[model samples]
Every structure is written in structure tokens, then in C-alpha cells.
Target chain A: MSEVVSALAGARASGMVELADAGATGMITLRGDHALLGAAVQAVLGLAMPEVRRVVAGEGAQVLWMSPDELLVITGYDVAPGLAADLQSALGDAFATVAVVSDARALIRLSGAQARDVLAKLCPVDFADFPVGALRRTRAAQVAAAVWRTSDSDWSLICFRSVAGYVWEALVTVAQPGGEVALYR
Target chain B: MLLLTCPCCGVTAEETEFANGGEAHLKRFGPGSDDADYEAYMFARKNPRGVHFERWRHIYGCGKWFLMARCTMTLEVFGTYRAQTSEPPAEIVAKIKARRPEWEGF
Candidate 1:
């Protein structure tokens, strides 16, 4: 078996905000009717379906509303590979596209008081009014990213694995020690 | 600088966040369709100065395709609806009619 290595081997940095790899997280992109998702989500994560643009985080799992007909399920890396079978069984004979896309993406965490500023600089989202648990899927610099608040001072961001190195550096660069925007504070 | 709302996810974001996918409500022609119908579907597009209908993908947000009714001149948006809808809903059509009385019917 190939050793599952994260895009960045647990890269960590602290500047305007704290940046760190979210390990080799597991992600599932579900595109189908909510009737099937509700059952699968309930069975897999024991959480209710999230509303549009909202993220439901529980324990070590999170269910994010990616669109009207799409949901992104995030869980621990090891638990992700086997989750497809479990989700398919829960979906029964219903039609849906369930894909285990953990390896296709990279997760990074930004914490500290200036974390929001770090995200705001790269992404065009209204961070001033952004509340916790609200998911914002927008462009981060030149790449697409899904962002959510884990706490008042902490944020989580997921982008394509191919751009992990660039995204990591971008996050770190935007969050330079003296580059604090101080807008969200 | 346009802040278009997405009916699917209900997120009103900048124009950069969404992608403009040309004209909306196009009746796709198939193999059995006449040449004229195919030509209209392929090349004919509405470029009205007053009211315009367009297809936009909320590429950065919900990743859903939706239709928008807006004024091509003023850049004022009338409304947005799901892409599954074949035509503009009654309320939106009425709104455009009331605002721009000379607009041709969709």
C-alpha cells in the first residue's frame, strides 16, 4: 500500500494568522436529491442535512451544503475510503453521484485574530458579517476554495490538491507578520 | 460590480463570483429539428437594450446554473430563478413589463 502523504507534510506557519495542514482529511462530493442525502448523511455522520451555504459540523465530521443539489461531506481520512459503501447502502436504490474526493483536495486551517483578514485578502467574501458555521465557496486568489469558520477566531479552507503548495504559500504570504489588514478586528 | 443573487443557494455575490453563460431559455434543437430551428438555436441571441435574459453559473459559490432577468442598458437586475425553469416566472415577467413597457415578450 502506498503511504498516504498529505499535499504538504503537515506544513505549519504563524504570521498574521496561524496556518497548518488539516492532515489528510476525507471528503465526499454528493450530487443528487436531498431525499437520498438526508438518509445517507444521517446514517454516516448522525447529523441533519445542512441548509444552503451552511455547514453542519459534528465531532470529527462536517456536512456542508455545496449547492442546491450538491453536498460535500468532510470526515477523518481513514473513515472516508469506506464511507462510500456505507453511504451507497444508506441511499438504497435511489439515484445519486457519490464520490470519495478526499485525495483530490487539500485542507488548511487558519486561526488567530487575523485569520479572517488572511481569507478576506484572497477571497472576495464579506468576512465582517460572516458568522460561524457559514460556508463560503469562493475564489481564493486565482483558485477556487471552500471556506468555513470553525470558531470566532479560527477558519478552515479547502482547495484543489494540485494547488495545495501554491495555496499554502499564498495563505502564508498574505498573512505576513506586518500585513495585518485589521478590518475584521 | 454586479451583485447577482442565486436562487439555488440564495447567495448574492459579485459578478466575478458568478460566470455569465450567454443568453438563457434557449430551446435546444435536436436531430429531428428543422434547419431553421437549429440555426436560431445556434446563432440567434437576444441583445435587447432594455430587458435581457441570461444564463449564469454560480461558479464559485453553489456551482448551480440559474437564469437572470435584467436590463441590458441600466444593468439593473429584475430577478433570478433556477435553471430548470423553462420560462421566466409570471411575477418576474410582470416586473419587467411594468418597468419597461416597450420590451418585447420573451
Candidate 2:
């Protein structure tokens, strides 16, 4: 049997932006009422439920508010199942649904001074208004993606596993030095 | 391109982030309805030049369906609201009326 490699294994860093595969991150899709889901997430991950279009980071987990009644919980890949289970137990019969979707999606981390610049090339969201902890579900190039700002110079983007390769290539292509032209900034 | 704000996620994104679901607040004409009523329900849409209500899905964003009230000609967005309601909220209707005095209620 052959071991699986990340889509960004051979991706070259552009110095201005660093791209890395956020290896085997755990992802859980949660759906339910805001109050119930928020409580469950806080109980399981010890992180406050983020406001709409925001993200909250805990010790080892991050909760992203995807919609009014939906959230995406991210943790270490190995711990995703356990987290989902914990969330399920926490919200049992509370009009909530929990599904482990770690393998359904791929995550990539972009950091450095020009990370936002690289993203602006493909995404339409104005990063200037996207403060840290802001999370947005938008299109990255041609693929559906969710982007979360983790820090001043860091962002994490997730796309479906099927298009991981395409998304990675697109980001790498735009992240290349002098590839991005700052139109908004 | 129109920029829409998804009420569910509070993310204001470009038109590309959203998929237009067409005229909102359509009353369904099910079986046993008159031909004219059914035809109107199926085909008739009010393409007003001024105030209009629309259904838009945040397809690439929070994936929630929402409603937007705006002026078709002026491109002035009155507001966006959740899709769960059967009709536009009173506040939104009032806002539109305040902006366009000749506007009629939905």
C-alpha cells in the first residue's frame, strides 16, 4: 500500500506568502439552534461559540460559525471523531445534528505579509474589513472555500477534498513573488 | 455586480457569492386552482422598475437562503432579511416606503 501525500507536498513557498497543508485536521459539521449548539460547543471544546461569520479558538480546537444554525468545529485530525462524539452526547436530543467530516475536506494555511494579497487575487472578499477571527465561506478561485483569519498575517482556508489539488495550485500560483497586484490596498 | 449581505452570516460579499432564486414571496397555486391563478403563480412575476423583493442564496457563503429588498432601477438596497419568514418584515417595508414614498406594501 502507498501512503497518501498532501496536495501541497511539493508546493514552493513564495517568501511573501507561506503555504502549508494543515495536515489531517479534524472537521465536524454541526447543525442546530444557535443556543443549543453554542452550549454544546462550549461544553465540548471549552471555546465560546463565535458570533456570526467569526471564529473562536480554544486550547486545541477552533469553532467557526458557518451560518445561523451551522458551525464547523476544527481540531487535530486524530481527535475529530472524539470531539464529534462528545458534541453529540452534549447535545443529545437538542435539535442538533453532528457529523464527522474530516476526510471530506482539505485545509491549507497561508501566512506571511502577502498572504492576504495572494488571497485577494482569487477571492472577492475585502480582507481589510476581515479582522482576526473573521470567518467567511466564499469562493477561492473557482472552488467553494471557507477562510478564517487566525492572526494578523495568517489565514486558514478549507475546500472540498476533491478540489484540494486545484485550490492548492491556484493559491501557490497566486502566492508566487510579484504574482499578485494589489488593487484594493 | 450587486453586493449582497447575508443576514444569517453577516458577510457582505459580491454577487458571485450568491445565487439569485428570483422573485420572493410567491404564493403557490396547487391543484384545483383556476388556470389563470396557476398560470400567474407559475409564470407571472412582478418586474417592477422600482422597489423589489428578491430571494438570494448565499451559495458560497453561509449557505443560507435570505431575502433582499432593493430598488431595481436605482440599485439602492433597502435591507436583507431571513428567509424563514413568510413575508417581508414590517420594518423593512417601512424603510422602503420611507425611501420611496410611492412604494406599495408587499
Candidate 3:
């Protein structure tokens, strides 16, 4: 097993203001004909359309519903390349179009006591009912993102590459060590 | 929360996702048309205090606009249908009659 990276090192390398990126986590985006995406995603990852809005995550994998038809899926950093190819093959040309966006996003994981509270202050969506295992496709701070709760106290927020640096800076600055903010790698 | 049923997207979504576009089935008088008729068309309206038929757009969902009749006092929703369609659904008519007994069978 690989040794866990130090929180301070993870934060500095990730440059996140809220929470640090484990730096090795893989982020991918799947966009296709909205009608076909649900089944395609289901076939690729054994997950279905996340129906709980911002409060629940899909069972097998951390799936966040980005829109009525769009979704975001997160997994271990090392699994990305193979999964991207598998996803592309599953939904060939029959589905209008299929695009595997493996490198278009920045994946940041925020865990700790103050994670939810800090997210609430940064994003507009109501967090009171946002339960673990749910995915939310909404604006994080002011940027478009797909947020998925991996556990009771941890969440994965994915955003576009352009604003990735900004988001990282914001989370790291607010994330404290002992109480409100904690870094997980 | 107010619920809107879109013809394309079906029955789902909160009122915040939609925009109210005013009364449904109301016709407008052209400038070249008769004067009194224009006056009646422009100024006169159903203005019903009970259930009112209105147009609403599902801005955040399927993006299709629809017409629905809902109670103003009770806020009870009747039914919804496509905006450009010729007539309201029979279910909507039935709901209107059921809610407003005076308009029964009309």
C-alpha cells in the first residue's frame, strides 16, 4: 500500500482553499446524448442515474447528477485511463455522440469536521438534506461543479480546469487543521 | 412549492424553475381591427378570483412553455398542457369544474 501523503504537503501541492486534492485521484467527465447517457454510464460503471439531487450518492460508485441528463463519476486516480476507454467503447456512435473528458476537470476531496459547513458558505445549494452517497450538480462558490459525498464527513467536488487553481486556493485558506478544516489525501 | 407539468418533461420540478407568462387562451386585438373590440380585448380579462388559467415556462428543465389552471385562493393546481395547442386537456377541464362548482359542466 502506498503511504498517505502529509496533509500540509497535499494542501500546498493541490493549492485548494477549502480542502486538498489527494493529487492522485482521477477525474473524468462523460457527455453524450442526454437520453443515452444514463444507460451508457450504468453499463460502464454499474451505476445508474443519481435521483436524489444534491443529497444522495449512487450505490456502487460515487455518482453525482449534474443535470436532468448529465452526471459526474469519481474514482481512484489510477483507474482513469482504463475507465475512459471502457466508457468510450460502451456508448459508441449510436448515441448521437460520446466524449470522454478525462482531463478537463480538477477533482478535490474535502473531509473533516467543518467540510459541510464550509461548503454551505461557499455554495448556494441547501446542505441540510444533502445526505452521504448523493451527488449534486450545482455551482460551487460561483463555478460549475459536480459534488459527490463519499462518506458522512467527506465530499468530492469536480470543476473545470480553468478555475481549478482558484477553487484550490479558496478551500486551503479556509480549511483549518484541528477543528473546522482537515485535509485528507 | 408550486409544481409544473411540462408536456415534454412530464410532471416534475419546483415553481422556482419556471416563469409565469400570464393568462392562457387570451387573444389580442390588432391595431387595424375595430375600436370597441380592441378596447374589450385589451382591457377586458377573465380576472377570475377563483381558479385562473395561466401560461408558465419551464425555464430550467425541458424549456417548453405550458398552460395550466390553478386556484388563486386555495392554490390548488388543476392541470397543464402545451401552450400552442388548440384546447386544454379534458382532465384539466374536469379539475376546473371540480374545484369551482359554479363552473361545473361549462
Candidate 4:
């Protein structure tokens, strides 16, 4: 099997906001009914099922409710393969699916006082109401993305691996000094 | 810009985040169907000037399909509901009826 690699290979840029590849984080996609998914996720990640369009954290893992029938599990890259198998086993013949999607995405971290301003320029989400722990899935410019605020000055984003390069460049350009709109500052 | 919400996930976002799936409650014609039925299913649409129900996909959000009832002329959204049902929910239909007294039923 070929070795997995991040799209940007840990590229970093220092501007009004710090934009860098957060590296290849493991991701597993689970699809099932609520009762079944809740049990399966708890048995495997020990994380509570997140509310609709929400994110829940527990122990060392995070569960994101991607849709009514879908969830995105975030965990260590090395453990993802094994965990996916475990999740499937936990589901146990019920109507559901679990697949490793770590290689299908790339993570980016944007942190600084101006991080919000940079992201607000590209995505259409209302940043003022987007508090910490709130998750939003929208387009950053043209590429689809799911973003969450870790703190007032820090943000994390994940997008398809194919568009990771574009997301990085877009963030870098918008993070340029003096580009700050200060609307979100 | 139209601000729509996905009933499945409860994400209210701008119209750009959704993909319009055309008029809602469409009766699909599959294999062995008559030519007229198939043609109507394929191309015919209700271009009502006032109240309307249409399907929308939260393409950038939850990626779920939902139905929205709104006025075609003003784009005033009446309500949005899950796409699982074969017809608009009674409450939404009633709301539309109350607002547009002369409007035809869904």
C-alpha cells in the first residue's frame, strides 16, 4: 500500500493570521440510524453523539454530526484503521456503514486575532454568531469546508484532500497583512 | 439571497449553500410508464406565481434534501419541512392557505 501524505505537507505562512497544514488527521465516516449510531459510536470512541449540526468531544476523540444519517469521527491517524473495524463490529449486522476517510481530507489550522476576519472573507457564515465549539459546513471561496472555532483567536478547518491546496492558498492570501476588515475583530 | 434551513439537520444558511431540486411533490414515472406521464414527470413543472413548494438540497451543509414552501413572486418563505413525506405537512399547508386565501391547494 502507498504511504499517505498531506496535500500541503505541513506548509505554513505567517500573516495577519497563521495558516498552516494541521497535517493528516484520521477520519471515519459512519452512516446509520440514530439509535444504532449512538450505540456504535459510544462503544468505539466513547464519545457522545453530537446534536444536529454539532460537534461533541470525549476522551481523545471528536464526533461531528454530518447529517441525520451520517457522522464524522476524528481520532489519531494510526488508530483510525483499527477503530473503523471496531466500529463496524459494534454496529453488528445492523443497517450501517463505516469507512476510513482520513486519506480523503486535510486539516488546516488558522490562529491569530485576525483569524475570524480572514475566514469571514471567504465563507458566507455569520462569524459573529459562530461561537467556540459551533461547527459550520460551507464553502471557503469555491471549495466545500467544515470549520470550527477552537477559541476566540483560533480556528480549524477540514476540506477534501483534492482542494486542500486551494484552501491553503486562499487562507494565506486573505490572511495577508492589512487585509483585515476588523469586522470580526 | 434566500435563506433556507435544512429540516433534517436544522442548519439555516444562505441560498448559496443549497441546490434547488425543482418543484416538490413530483410524481415520478419510471419503467413501463406511459409517454405522457414520463414527459410530464421529466419536464412539466408548476410555475405558480404565488405560493409554491419546492425541494432543496443542503449541498454544503448536512447534504440532506428538504422541502420549502414559499411565494414565487416575493420569495417569502412560509416554512420548510422534511423531504421524507409524500406531501407537505398539514401545518405548512394550512399556513400557506391562511396567507393566500385564494391560492390553489397543494
Off by over 4 Å in 2: A1-12, A180-185
Which lDDT tens digits does candidate 4 get at residues B10-70? Answer: 7788999999988999988998999999999999998988998899999988888899999
lDDT of 1 by residue, B1-106 (tens): 7889888888778899999999999889988899999999999887877888999999988788899999888899988988888999999999999988887788
Which sections of candidate 4 miss by over 4 Å? none
* Model 1 native-contact share: 0.79
Report the C-alpha lDDT of model 3 over B5-104, residue by residue, as the tens digit.
6664563545765778887887778989899889988888777778788899865444467888888877778878778765677887887877687863
Top candidate, metric lDDT:
1
Which stretches of model 3 miss by more than 4 angstroms?
Answer: A1-18, A32-39, A52-61, A76-78, A173-185, B1-106
Worst 10-residue lDDT window, candidate 2 chain B: B1-10
Q: When only chain A is evaluated, what TM-score does every model earn? A: 0.96, 0.92, 0.70, 0.95
Tens digit of lDDT per residue, candidate 3, span A59-137? Answer: 4345555544455566665676677678777777655343445456777778665667667656654566666766654
Error of 1 at A14 (Å): 1.3
DockQ by candidate, in order? 0.79, 0.79, 0.07, 0.79
Candidate 1: residue A183 Cα off by (Å): 1.3
Clashes of each: 0, 0, 18, 0
* i-RMSD of all predictions: 0.9, 0.9, 5.5, 1.0
**Which 10-residue span in candidate 4 chain A carries the lowest summed lDDT?**
A51-60
The DockQ ranking, best first, is 4, 2, 1, 3
Candidate 2 local Cα displacement, residue B2, angstroms: 1.3
